[model samples]
Target: MFQQFRYFKPIITISLIMLISGLIISCGSTSSIPIPATPTKEVEVAVVPPPTPTTPAVPTSVPAILAPDDSCVNCHSDEVQLLLTSATEEVEVELSEGEG
Candidate 1:
């Protein structure tokens, strides 16, 4: 038993020394390697021209359009009537008529 322990003691000490040296080398300061510069090749991109503009086709059939009427206020007024008079001192705000 004593002879076997004596033989293994040197082997264990060498293994521990190697492991500690590996750890110390791995934990050293990190340095970045410089990369060699190379010339970049020019890349050609394909550009497509826009299509020629053309006059739009006119409507074959006329669409039925809604005619403006004052009767729409009967249900949309929320039962509240707003009176507008020329002599009234309230703020007058009127929407401009559309050309369409």
Candidate 2:
């Protein structure tokens, strides 16, 4: 009989442990101490006026040209133009080849 129920021992132990834990968790202390409410005094606060907003200085005009010493203008201007030209040529060749 013990040999036949040996496999069920761990399951039964775990179930019993879970059942006791659930009962212990459900039987928590319900009694709470009553807290006395503190009396609040009326506080006098000085009202402050909102500060006036000042207008930000607007730029009269934006310069059309970038600064001459700008590195991006120097480095990318020619490379970007070359890339655009090559891409345009590729599209033109593809169009011509398709037509022919």
Best of the candidates, lDDT: 2
Q: CA lDDT, every prediction?
A: 0.68, 0.69
How close is every model to the real structure, measured as TM-score?
A: 0.29, 0.28
lDDT, candidate 2, 1-100, per-residue tens:
8986898899999999999997777666344535567889889898654454775555556575866566855546698776765644443334454454
| Whole-model lDDT, model 2 | 0.69
Please, what are the lDDT tens digits per residue for candidate 1 over residues 20-44? 9988876673544345668797888
Task: Please identify model 1 stretches exceeding 4 Å from their true place.
Answer: 29-100
Q: Cα lDDT for residue 90, model 1?
A: 83
Worst 10 residues of 2 by lDDT: 87-96
TM-score for predicted model 2 compared with the true structure? 0.28
Candidate 1 is scored at a TM of 0.29
